[model samples]
Target chain A: MSRYLIQFAYDGGSFSGYQIQPNALTVQEELEKKLSILAQRKIEVVGSSRTDAGVHASQQFAHFDCPVPIQKDWVYRLNRMLPHALAVISIEQVADDFHARFDALSRTYHYWIVRKKTPLRRHDTYWFEAPLDLEAMNAACQILFQYIDFECFSKVKTDVFTFDCTIQKAIWTEEGDFLKFTIQANRFLRGMVRAIVGTLLEVGEGKLKPEDLHQIIQSKDRNQAGRAVPAHGLHLVEVKYK
Target chain B: MSRYLIQFAYDGGSFSGYQIQPNALTVQEELEKKLSILAQRKIEVVGSSRTDAGVHASQQFAHFDCPVPIQKDWVYRLNRMLPHALAVISIEQVADDFHARFDALSRTYHYWIVRKKTPLRRHDTYWFEAPLDLEAMNAACQILFQYIDFECFSKVKTDVFTFDCTIQKAIWTEEGDFLKFTIQANRFLRGMVRAIVGTLLEVGEGKLKPEDLHQIIQSKDRNQAGRAVPAHGLHLVEVKYK
Candidate 1:
């Protein structure tokens, strides 16, 4: 059997989520169907991460084992069969032991907020009509990197065993009329990024003090955190593997 | 009667077009309906531009006359009543003679293209899987400013009497993975910007020579020009008036 590592991209708007369901459409289901058709056999794809419904991913990694040897142009052929919103970026032969999910090292996520009232980009970006205090939000974001436990921000009844996540970097930057929060971590809990962004927006809107962020994290109570931000603003930028 | 200039924004994806059609939902229809309900009388709004279906506007200008004075906070009220994708950014009292369409000085458009093969931003930006030659595209863009008659790029069967337009600025710039073209002109014929972008993309892909752009413009034949780029990639960035 030959194992192949596939790098793909998809717009999350049309998907129920990354994982498979009984009748709902998903990125994984579509890809597996296409891969099965190309290989002339049924195939199942294992993804590195299970992104939530309405969450977008730019570069997602997956692995599949095939009975037949794969050709170099499989990437080109798969892309042709896929829809315009989903694309197969690259494909390569992987060692039999190299699993896409198990070998992943880290992941990066970006959340976008449009401060100005723009009709053109409303669907793609979260619009904040009130003036935001970016400096205050950044100050609060600095506290996030210092914490390892994010139980306060995680969704309840999550399958993940531990809430411990080492945040490598968390910073907020403004580009044009958009405020972007880029965060890197070993792994993220369910609804963690959206919860964190919502908390940060509270700081930006002067509802919560910058120093209160640490207190909320220590509270270890989901209710202590602000409301989760909308999913459309969040994007999984990249996943790293070693 | 008092005339008010309203600055609006809308995601054109849900609308048939800006103009009111017999059986189609339009931006104008939505706004007029809301305004008439609020005023307890029939109302009409004259927009500065009638954008095509699926074409978004960030800062669209419109004018409507009201017999009674309106409170400044009506802007906030109108926004709260409108859909998430449509917003009234500002409303101001204007001269009785002010015309949203005829009094316009210049309009700016922005076209977004994503060079990478990624799915996360599919609807937000145009995705071109092929590698683009930016320098060649920019070289061709320079030729756009030198042209006066843009009949070659205008849509066929348009009712506009004159094809003469002075393009004040036309340039392509790359930011991260996005290639954006910003064009400002005194006036634009229907489909002109998309046609120009389509032709310029041909130059970027090495399908057409940069010098051939001038010839395409001089030919004044819509069929000779490249295909009209998709409306989702184009945005009315700003409209200026004096």
Candidate 2:
């Protein structure tokens, strides 16, 4: 059997989530189903990230083993079978032992916020009308890299061995009427990004001081942090590998 | 009775067109249907521009006659009743004699072209991979201002009293990874903006000379013009009034 890795993008609003469930549609389920039909056999796929429902992905990776070698027309044929929301950007043959999840070095996420009522960007962006202080928000992002434990931002009941995470970069950039928050990390816990975003927004809103994030992270209490932002505004942008 | 003018926006993929017709969903029909329900009386609306199917509008206006005066909570309540793809930005009372169609002085349309497969912008932007010559396209736009009749760039079977239109502004602007064509005219013929965009793309592709547009316009024959571009990439951005 040969292992194949494919990079894809999906609109998260179309599926319940990335992982397979009993009744709801999912990205992994659709990919496995389409791949199995193409290969004429059952195929199980492993994704690098299990993004939440309504969380979009610009670049996601998955690996699967197939008895037949990679077909030249597989990407084109697979895309034709996938829905408009799910698309396979590219595919390549990888070593049999190369794991999509374990081999990933880092992952990046973006949270998009728009000011006015936008019809085109409704599904993916959060409409935030209040004035924001970007300098304060950026200052809060700096506090994230100072700590390795993000338990304050993660979901309380998640099953995880450790809450330690290395944040490589975190910054907020203003792009014409949109405010985008970008964060890159070695690893993330469930609901970590959204919770961080919501906490940072309080800083922008003048409710939480920039230095308060340090205490929140030190507290390591989920309730100590701000509320978790909506899943629709968050996106899984890139998954990096060494 | 009072005439109220509402400035709104819509994703044209949600409707067949701006006009009401048999056995088809339309923006005008939706507005009339909802307004009728809100007023508890039959309400008729007249749109400033009849946009084509699959086209989008960032800002559009429609005037409707109501038995009652403008309601304070109409905008908020109407938006709740509208679909996610449709929204009411604002509403105000206009003069009883004011005409939505005839009182409009000019209209601005934008055609967005992107060079990459943007999954987020798929519905509103045309994915064009060719290297465009903006200088050639801009030169062709300047030539448009020198002429009045645009018969060659209009649909062949359209019914209109005259084909003359006054060009106020026409130019192509590069907006960081996207090419946008903006055109404002006192009036337009059927399929005029899209046909002009398609023919200008030929100039950018080196298929047609920039000067060739002069002859094409003078031909006054629809067969002389290039094919009309897809409607999805076009947007009715503005409608000015005296």
Candidate 3:
């Protein structure tokens, strides 16, 4: 059997999520159905990450094994067969032992928030009517670097074993009228980035003190965290593997 | 009566166009309906330009007259009442003789073409799969500045009285994987920018010679031009009046 590593991108607006479910449309199911048809056999794809519904991905990696080698033009042919909102950008042969999800080293995410009200980008970016205090938000973001446990920000009843994650980079930048938060971590718990952004927004809005973030992290309670931000503003920017 | 000039923005994917059409939803109709409800009086808005269906506008201008003066806070209030995809950014009192379309001094347009295949921006930008000769396209763009008449690119059956428009700036810039064409002019005829982009793409693809653009403009026939590019890639960047 030959294993192939596929790099793809998708707009997750119309999908339930990346995982497959009965009676629900998903990115994985769509790709598998097409690949199976092309190969004239059943095929299953293993994704690097399971992004939530309405969350976009700029670069996502996956792996699939086939009994026969595929042509180089299969990448272009698969793209044409898929919907315009999903594309298979590249395909390459990989070692049979390489798995997309288990063999990843780190991942990065970006959350976009438009400070000024813009109708053109309303759907693509989250709109914050009130002015954000960038300095305060940045100060609070510094607290995240000191903590390795993020149980306060993780979603409840998640399948992951532990909430420990080493966050390498968490920085906010302002571009024109948009404020973006880019975070890189060894791994992320479900809904962690959104919860972090929500808490940072509270700091920006003066509802919570910057130092209070430390207390919230120590509390280890989901309720201590701020509300989760909308999914549309979140994007899986990159996935790294060694 | 007081005349007010409003700077607006909208995602044109959902509506038919900017103008009111029978049995079709439009940006004008939506705003008029909301204004009537708010003011308890019938209202009509005259937009700076009637954008075609599926064309987006980042900073469109419009004017409407009301019997009573409006407060500064009306900008935020109107935005709350408008749909999420449409917004009124600024409102200012204007002279009674001022008209949004006729009094405009200049208009700017931006066309986005993604060189790489990206699924996330499929609906937002045009995808050009083949490698583009951007330098050749820029060279062709420079030729556009020498011509004052663009009757060849204008849509047929257009009601404009004159076919002459001063091209102030026409340049193409490459940023990362995206190529953007920005043009500023005193006025534009219908389908003018799209036709220009289409012909330029033909030149970039080696399907048409760069010098043929000047010949096509001199022909002054719509049939002499290439196909009009899709409307989604076109954006009304700015409208200026002095």
Candidate 4:
């Protein structure tokens, strides 16, 4: 048997989510079904991140074991079989024990918001009409690196073992008519990035002071933080492996 | 009567075309229908450009005359009535003699092509996997400034009086994963820009030499030009008057 690692991208608009559901379409179900047909056997694949419905991904990784050796041109052939919204960019042979989810070093996400209505960016960006103070938003992001416990930003019903995470970088930038928030971390809990972006936007709106995030983190209370932003505006940009 | 000029943008994928047809949805039809409802009177609008189906616009203009004065906040209210694929950016009062199509000084268009498949940019860019020679394409564009007749590139059945168009600027540039061809002209024929881009790409693909364009233009024959590219990759970026 040979294990293969595949890097791909997907437009999450038409997908229910990354994981397979009983009667719904998903990224995993689509890939496994296509692979099974191509390989003449049942195939099960593992994904690195289970992104929420309507969340896009510029880069994602997956792993699957095949009973027979696959050719290098499988990447091109696989893309031809898949829908235009989902594409396989590259495929490579990996060690038999390599795991896509457990062996990742870090991940990065970007949340895009625009102040005005943009017909071109309606699906790709969150349209927030309120004026934002960029300086105040950046100030709140700086306080993120000081703490490790992020229970306040995570979903309460998640089954994760720990609420602690090491954030590598957090920054807010303005590009033309859009405001983007980018964050990288060793590991993230469910709904962490959206929750953090919503909280920082509150600071930009003058509802919460820049220093209030410190208290919110210390309280370890989910209600202490702001609301979670929408999923359509979030993008999984990178997945790193060692 | 008060003549108002409105600036807007649209994602042309959902629109059949810019002009009104018997049974098709169009940008002009949507605007006129909504404005007639808002004003409680029949409103007919004249557009700056008649963009083909699936052609986007970053900035476009239209003019309409009304008997009653409009409030300043109508810009916001009108946007609420329009679909998400179309938006009104600015509205201003103009002189009675002003015309959106005839009085324009120049118009600029951008054609985007990508060498690789990108899920995020699938709708906005044309993907062509062939290797392109940037230097050869730009050399052909420099020859555009010397000619005033482009009948070879215009649509065969167009009803325009003259095939003369002054080319102010033509340039090809590369950015990250995309190649952009930008052009400005005093006026353009029915399918001139797309035809020119198609021929330039032929130059880039080494199917045609840079010097071959001189003969193609001088031939005054539509059959001598290259194919007209797709409408989805074309964007009406700017229109200027005065």
Candidate 5:
């Protein structure tokens, strides 16, 4: 069998989620169905990140194994057949043993907080009415460097072997009317990024101090943290591989 | 009765067009429906520009006459009631005789051409695989300066008093991978911008000479010009009023 890896982007507003299910539309199912047609068989794909519903992906990856070598012009042909919400940006052949989910490097996610409301960006941006304190937000980001286990930020019923994740980068950058919160980690728990952003926004909103993040991390209690923000504001920007 | 002029922005992908039609969703109808509820009476608005289906507007205006004074908080209230594809940006009181359509001084339109395809901009941009010579396109833009009767570029069977328009500005600007064609004029005929863009593209494609535009304008034949481009790529950027 030959392993082929693909890098893609999707507007998650169109799908239920990344994983395939019985009744609803999914990114994985659409990709797998398209790939199966191209391969003339039932070809399954393993995604690197299982992003939730309404969470967009600027750069996501997946790997699939096929019995025959993939054709050269498959990228152009596959993109033509894909739905408007999904597209295949690039494709490459990897080692037979390569995996998509269990990769070697970190993943980056970005959450956009738009100050002004525009009709064009209603899908991908979260409109925040209150004035945000960027100084407090960035200050809270520094507190995240001390922790590895983010159990307080994970969903309550998530199935995970370990809550430990190596934090590489976490910062809140101001882009005009848009406040972008970017985080990079070796691995993430379910509902991690949105929860962290929701909690950090408390610091920006004056509800919580910057140092309050330290206590939240040490509590290891999901109830101690703020509620998770809406999924539409989050995007899987990149999944690095070695 | 009081006349009010309101400026708004719309995604335009969700509406059939700017004008009201039977059994079709339109920007004017939606605005009238919401405004009538806010004013507690029947309200009618005259739009400054009649954009075709799938055309966006960053700054479009309308003037309406209402029996009672509009509330101060109606902008916020109407925006909440409006669909995701449209928004009432600003509202203000105007003279009783003020008209939306006839009182406009100039209108600006932009056509976006994308060299690369991204999932987010799929609705608003036109993806062209052809290599365009922008120098030739800009030269054709200069050729438009000497002409007033653009009947060849106007859509056939269009209801218009005259094809003569005062062309104030026309240019193609390159912003990274996106080429924006901006045109400002005192008035525009139905399908004029798209046809002119289509004909100018032929010049960029090396299919037609820049000076050939003179003969096309003189001929005053709709079939003598190139085809009108798709409506999705066009945007009514601004409608100047005095």
Candidate 6:
């Protein structure tokens, strides 16, 4: 048996999510189906990130063990067989112990918000019509680094055991007409990034103070925090491994 | 009667073309249909640029005469009523003699070519797999300004009386992962911009020399030019008027 690592990108607007579902189409299901057909055997892929429906990815990694030897042109072949929204950038042999999920060093996400409505970027941006205070939002971002427990930002009734995640980097900047947020962490709980962005936006809108975030995080309750932002505006941009 | 100039943008992937057709849907048909409903009368609009099918427009202008007075908030109302692929940027009353297509001083087009395949921008850019020499392409751009007739770059079945158009600016530059071509002219023939880009790409690929364009233009034969590139990669970015 041989293990191989695959790097890919996907536009998640047409998918249900990354994980497999019984009745809905998903990124994992599509990848596994195509891989199984190519290998002439049932193949299961372990994905590095389980992005939600309507979330895009610029770079994602996965690993699978195969009984057959793979060729160098599998990237081109697999991309041809897969749907247009999913594309495999490269595939390479890896050690047997490389787990795409658990072995990942860090993950980064980007959330995009546009103040003006444009028809060209409707799917990729969240149209936030109200004026936002960027200085206040950045100040609130600084407050998030002081804690590791982000239960206030996660979705309720998830299968994960712990809500602890060590954030490596978090910053907010303006890109032309877009207000972008970038955050990196060792691991993320269900719906964590969107929830954090939604809360920060409330701070920018003057509905919440920067210090209010400390109370929200310490409360260990989802209801104490602001609402989760829409999934369409969020992107799983990068996943790093050592 | 009041003549108003309306500026808008559209993702032309969903449109057949800008002009009205008998059985197919076009940008003009959608705009007229919606405007007629809003104005409570039959409305006909003339567009500044009649972009081809699958070509995007960032800033397009149109003129329509309204019998009733329109509110200043019509931009918001028209955008809300239009489909997701179309948006109205601004609307202002113009002189009675102002025409959308006739009085335009210049028009500009932008063509995007991406060497790398990314799923997020599949619809917005042309994926040119081969290596392109930017310097060679720019050298060929300089050869275009010395010519007045671009009959070799026009569509064969067009109904234009004159093939003469003065070229103002033609340049090629790098934009992130894309090699962008921007061209401006007083007028353009059908399929002119795409053909120019295709011919320049041939020059970049080392198949044609910079001086070869002069012979093709002087030949006055459409068959002498390269093939017209895909419309999906072309965008009518700007339309200027006095």
TM-scores of chain A in all candidate models: 0.96, 0.99, 0.97, 0.97, 0.98, 0.98
The fnat score for candidate 3 comes to: 0.78
lDDT of each: 0.87, 0.91, 0.89, 0.91, 0.91, 0.90
lDDT (10s digit) by residue, model 1, range A1-242: 89999988777777888899988989999999999998889999999989888888888999999998787778888887888778888888889999888798999999989876666566557888787898999899889888899999999978888999999988899999899999999899999999999999899999999999888999999999999998888888899988
Question: Per-residue lDDT for B19-84 in model 4, tens only?
Answer: 999999999999998888878899999999999899999999999998888778877887889998
Candidate order by TM-score, decreasing, is 3, 5, 6, 4, 1, 2
Q: What are the runs in model 6 whose C-alpha is more than 4 Å off?
A: A37-40
Alpha carbon deviation, residue A237, candidate 1 (Å): 1.8
For residue B46, model 5's alpha carbon misses the true position, in angstroms, by: 1.9
TM-score of every candidate relative to the true structure: 0.87, 0.80, 0.95, 0.93, 0.94, 0.93
Task: List candidate 2 stretches off by more than 4 Å.
Answer: A1-7, A19-46, A62-100, A128-159, A168-177, A198-228, A240-242, B36-40, B71-73
Fnat of each prediction?
0.75, 0.42, 0.78, 0.62, 0.57, 0.62
Ranking by DockQ: 6, 5, 3, 4, 1, 2
Better of 1 and 4 by TM-score: 4
Instruction: Give the distance in Å from residue A43's predicted Cα in candidate 1 to where it truly belongs.
Output: 2.5
Q: Over the true interface residues, superposed, what is the Cα RMSD of model 6?
A: 1.1
- DockQ, computed on Cα atoms, for candidate 6: 0.68
Clashing pairs in 4: none
TM-score of 1: 0.87
The model with the greatest TM-score is: 3
lDDT of 6 by residue, B1-242 (tens): 99999888999998998999998879999999988988999999999988999999999999999999878777777888898789888889999999999999999999999877777778888878788888988988998999888999999999999999989999999988888899999999999999999999999998999889889999989888888899988999999998
Q: What is the Å distance of residue A59 in model 6 from its true position?
A: 1.2
TM-score of chain B of each: 0.96, 0.98, 0.96, 0.98, 0.98, 0.98
Q: Candidate 3's error at B83, in angstroms?
A: 1.6
Cα distance off (Å), candidate 3, residue B14: 1.9
Decide which is better by lDDT, 1 or 4. 4
Clashing pairs in 6: none
lDDT, candidate 5, B33-91, per-residue tens: 99999988889899999999899998999999988888889998888899978988899
Any residue pairs clashing in model 1, and if so which?
none
Candidate 2's displacement at residue B176, Å, is 3.5
